[model samples]
Target: MYVAVKGGEKAIDSAHDWMAEERRGDPDVAELSVPQIREQLSLAVNRVMAEGSLYDPDLAALAIKQARGDMIEAIFLIRAYRTTLPRFGASLPVETTEMACDRRISATFKDVPGGQVLGPTFDYTHRLLDFALEAEGLEAPEREAGEAAHPRMPRVTEFLNQEGLIQTEPRPDVDTAPRDLTREPLELPAGRPLRLQALSRGDEGFVLSMAYSTQRGYAKNHPFVGELRIGTVPVEVEIPELGFAVEVGEVVLTECETVNQFTGSKLEPAQFTRGYGLVFGQSERKAISMALVDRALRWKELGEDDKGAPAQDEEFVLYHCDNIQATGFLEHIKLPHYVDFQSELELVRRLRRETEGRVQQEAAE
Candidate 1:
C-alpha cells in the first residue's frame, strides 16, 4: 500500500533540498561570507542575537545567511542551536556607568555629566537613498577621531537620586538569586527581574506595540526618556579558586531609563518613578520600548490603579512576547489535517442527507 505519511516524508526532504538551492540565488553572484554579514549587516545580526536569547555574532550571522535574511527564521535557528550548547556559570551584572560610551543622550536633562555623544545614528539623516552605495568599492567618508580613553560616565538617574527626587530601585535585603525563565517555567505574578529578562529577549515588534499602546492612552503613565546609553561594558564572573571576580570579556549594550509618573500616600512623599531597559546591542528603539512596557507592567507594584490595558496585563504580555511561541502556534494550521477534516466532512454530509430526506417526506404529506 502507498502510505500517505511515507510519501509526505519524501516530499518534505525534497522541499528542503530545493530550498537549499534557492538560497544560493544566481550562480554568477559572489557568495556572501559569514564575516561580511557580521560586519556589514550588524543590525540584523543584533536583532537575531537579542530575540534568539543568544549573544554569538558569528552564529547569528550564519543563521541569517541560512534563513535568507528572514529575521524570525534566523532567530528560530539560533534558538534551536542554543538548546544543544553546554551551559556555563552565570556572569555578574555588568556595570553600565563604566561602559565605553558609543552613544549617550538624555531627553529630560539639557546636558548630562558625560555630555551627549551622538555616535553613529540614523536619527538626523535625510531619508533620501544614497545611490553611492550601489557603486562597487566605494570608500566610506572619514571623520576626525575623538579621545581614546573611556571615562566613567555617571548615570543621569544618579543626579535625581542624589536629591531623592526619584524612587530608588528595589533590592532584596538578602542577595537572592534572580529567576531564570529559560531554565525554569514562567510562573504568573512574576517579579521585575523575571519580567525584564523576558522583555530583553522578546520580539521587538511585540514589545514596541505594547509600548505604543501605553503612549496612545491605553495605560498612560506619562513617561519621559530619562536617559539612553549604548556602549561596550566589561563582563565579569566570580572565580571560586581566586575568591574574587575577574573580567571575562566585554559586550555591547543599550540601556534606557524612563522617568514615570509619581504616586504617593500619607505615609510617603511622591517621587518620580523609573523603568529600566537593557538589551544586547545598539537597539535604542527596542530599549526605549522595553522601558515603556516595563513601566506599564508595574501598575500594581507602583501602587497605581490597574488600567486594564493590554500592556498592563502581565500574563498577556509575557505569554505573547515570544515570537517563537507565537509563530509555532500560528503556523501549525498549515500542516496536514486529513483525518480531522475527513471526520468533519462526513458529519456535514450525513446531516445534509437527513435534512433532504425529511424535506421530501414533508412534501409528500
Candidate 2:
C-alpha cells in the first residue's frame, strides 16, 4: 500500500517564491534593466532571436530577464510568444548582395572585392576577464565620428561559379511555398529548406558539437569558409492591394557560405559543393556550424556514401537538436513516481523470495 503524495501546488508555489527571490539577488544592488541587456548583452539577445525564430530584441531581452539568464528558457519563452502572434504576410526574400555589411571575411580569398572588414569580433581578443567592468561608473569608449560608406560587396561563391567549380542549388518551383516545421509535422526525407530551417533554430551547442565531430574526421568534407558576412538587410512584403512589394523593416543577419570538396561520381563530374547558413543576427558560430551540418546532411543528395556519422543522420540530428525538448524530458525525472516505484519494489522482493524458496527446496531434496 502506498499513500499518494500531496501539497504539490503549495510546494510549487514556494519553489517559485524562492526562485523569484534568488532571481532578484541583493535588493540593494541596482536591478539589470532590459535596455542594458538588449544593448550590452546583444550577442545573447541575438542568440535568443536566432533560436526562437523571432527578431524583436526588446521581447528577447524581456524573455531573458524572465528566464533569469537561461538562454534556452529565454528562447522557449520567445518561441511561445511568437506562436500567438497573427501572421500578416510572408516577406519577400531579402537580397544579401545588397546587405549593408558591418563584418565580412573569406578564408578562400584574402583580397575580395569589398575588402575584409573586421567589424566587432572576438576572434583576436584575449580570454581574460576585465575586472574594470566590475567597477561602478566606468565610462564607455568614445565613438569616432563620421561613418564610412559601405560599398556593395560581391559574394565569394560567385567568383567560383564563374569557373563552374561549385554545385548550384536547385531552383524551387515559384508556386510552391516552403513547408513550416512549426505548423506541420516533420516528415522523413526532408528537403534542404526544411533541414536548413530546423538547423537555423536548432540549439547552438548541439549544432556546434555536430560540426566539431565532422571536423575531427567523422565525415571530413574538406570544408572552407568561402564567406561569412554580418549586416542589416531590408525586409519587404508584397501587399495584394498594392501589387508591389514594400519595405516593411530591416533585420540584422549573419550569413555563412561553406565550400566543400566532393569526389566525382560515375554520373556527375568532380566539383566543389556549397553549404549555406543564414541566421537572425551576429551569430557566426551558430551560422558556421549550421552550414557545416547542412553540408553533412546533403551527403545523399550529393551522391556521397553515408559514413554513418551522427551529423549525416538527418533524423537523429534534427530530433535531438532541440534543447527545450531534451531538457523537459531530462528534468521530468524529478517528478514523483511513488506508485510505480512501489510496484517495482514489490516485484523485486517477490522474485527474491521465490529464488530463496527454490534453493531451500532443492537442498531438502
Candidate 3:
C-alpha cells in the first residue's frame, strides 16, 4: 500500500536549518572570516568571480567557505547573489587598449608593440612541490626603490598590423550599447562579443571540456593564443550628475585572443580569424578556452560549412550553461512527485493488461 507523501514544507524548513548548521560547522572550532577566505583561497575566489560574473571577491570567498570549498557551489552562491543586485546603470565599455597590465604576452610574433611582459605566471615553474609552503613561516619579497612600470600598455596586435600579418579587428561604435542578458532573454545567433559574455559566465568545466574536445580533433579548430593579458581595468560609468565618466571601481580581468587560420573565399582574402575571451580576475585557462569556443561557434559567420559538431550549435551551448540554472533543475528531481508517478503507474497497468488479453486471443486463433 502506498502512503500519501506530505510534510514537504516542514522537510524544506528542516533542510534549510541543517544546511545553516553545516555551514557554521563546530562552534568550538575557529570560524572562517570572509577576509581570511578571500586572502587564503584566492584561486577559488577567482574561479567563482570568473564564472559567476561578479567581481566581489569577499562574497565569492564566503560562498567557497559555506560550500566547503566546492568550486561549483561557490559559483552558484555568487550567481545567486549576482541576481539579487539591482542594475544601477551601464558602464562605458572598458578599453583594453588603456588597461594597466600586470602580465601581457603574445604568441603570434617574436616581438610585439606591447613588449611582452611575463609579470606573474606559473608557466616556467617546476612541477615539484615547494616544501617551504608546508611551514607556517614565510618572508615577503623586498620592494625595490626607483622602479616604475611602463607609462602605457600597448596592444600586441599593433605589431602584426605593422607587418600586415593579420587584419585589424573592426571596432563597432562605442555608442551602440549592448543588451543586458540578465535583464532580457538571450536570443540565438548572437555576435561573438555577446556569445563570449554568456560563455564567460557559463559552466567552467563544461566550457573547458568542450574546448578541449575541439583541440583533440573532434572539430576543425586550430587555435594559437595571439595574446593573453591579466590586468586591472577601470570601470567607468557615466553619471548625469557628474556630467562625465568616473571610475567607480576597478576589476581584474584576463583577456585572450586566439588566432585561427582561414582560407580565401570569393568575397574576402585569407585573413587571420579571431576568437576572443574576457573573464573577471586571473582566469587564463577559462579565458583561453572561451576564445576557442567563440571561434568555433563563428564557423557560419566566417563562411565555413557547419560540420554538425557540438561547437557549431549555439543553442546547445548557451542553453546548457549557467551552473545556477543547471543545479536548480538537477536538484529539483529529488523533490517528491507522487501525483505524476501515480498517473504513470495507472497508464502502464492498463496498457499491460490490454496487451496480454489481445495476445491470448490471437494465440487461440
Candidate 4:
C-alpha cells in the first residue's frame, strides 16, 4: 500500500544548488574569501582543525565556508575528506619543549622561567561591541617596534618535578605502539594515550559541559593550571630509507597542564597528579576543559572513589563525545518511519479495545 517516493537524486541535487546559492548571499557584495576566513576568523578555523583532527588551515577554512560557519558541520566535512587521503608514515612525537611560545601562563607559579607572556588573549577584553568597526576608517593598534624576543620558557610543571611533588609520565618506549582510535574500536579501561586522542578530537561544547560538571562538585579533583602555552611545534616524520626523522611541517598547538592534588595512598606517598591537554591551535578554553576532564577520567587509575559523575564515566563520555555520530543519529529521525509508526499505532489501538472490553465485563458482573 505504501508507495516509495522517487526522484531523490534530483531533489538532492536541487537542494545542493539552493544551499550553494544561500552560501553565497548577495552577489553584489564582495564574496568572503577563504584566506580572509583563515586569518580573520582564525579561532573558528582553529576549532574546526582541532575537532576535525586535521592541521591544514586552508582546508579548514574551506570546510567552514562550505558548512556556512557551523563549526561542527565543518569538522564533519574535514573528517570526511581526511578519510580519503592515503596513509603515509606517522609523525614522531612533537617536542613541546622547543616550542616558540606566543602565549604562556601558569596559575600554579607566580614567576616561571619565561615571564608570563599574555599574548593575544581576549581574557581582559571588554565585552562591549565595537560599533566603529561597522564603518570604514578603523585604525590598527600601534605595536611596540623591535620588541625583545620572548625568553625561552620552561614548563611550570618542571619546578614541581624537581621536588618530586608531581607524578612523572612514563618514558617513551620505541617498541610501544599507541592504540589508534580511528583504526581500532574503543574498548573499556582505555589508557591515557587513547583517552587523550578522544578528548583532543571531541566536541568542544560537550567537553566543556563535562568539565563544568566537575567544577560544580560532581567529581571535584582540585585542579590548578600548572602551565598553559600556545605555540608552534615542528612535526617530524621518520624516513625508513634514510633511517632518521625529518621535519615534515610545523603546527600551532595549545597545551595545558593541570596539576591536581592527590591524598597519599597506602602504597605511594602523596604527590600531585597531572592532566594534560594538547589541541591543534589557540583554543585555550577547550584545552583547559579537556585537562579537567582528562584528570577526572583518571580517577580509576589514581585509586580515588568514582562519584559516578557523567564526566567520570569513561564509556559515557567517549561514546557521546563525537559530534558526527551524535548529529547523524539525531538527524536520522527525519528519515521514513511509516512501518515503525504503523506498528506502534496498531499496538495502541489493540490495547485500548482490550481495556474497554474488560471495563464492560466488570460492569456486567
Q: What's the CA error at residue 120 for candidate 3, in Å? A: 3.0
lDDT of 2 at 55: 96
Cα deviation in Å at residue 200, candidate 2?
0.5
Worst 10 residues of 3 by lDDT: 1-10
- Candidate 3, residues 268-295: lDDT per residue as tens digits? 6887778888888888888998998888
Note the Cα lDDT for every prediction shown.
0.90, 0.91, 0.82, 0.90
Pick the lDDT winner. Answer: 2
lDDT (10s digit) by residue, model 2, range 62-162: 99998999999999999899999998778988899999999999999989999998888999999999998888887887756634567899999999989
Stretches off by above 4 angstroms in model 1 are 1-3, 172-174, 351-365
lDDT of 4 at 306: 87
What's the distance in Å from true for residue 149, model 2? 2.3
Local error of candidate 1 at 254, Å? 0.6
Q: Over the stretch 24-60, how does candidate 4's per-residue lDDT look in tens digits?
A: 9989988999998999899999999999988999999
Q: How many clashes in each candidate?
A: 0, 0, 0, 0
Output the TM-score of candidate 3.
0.89
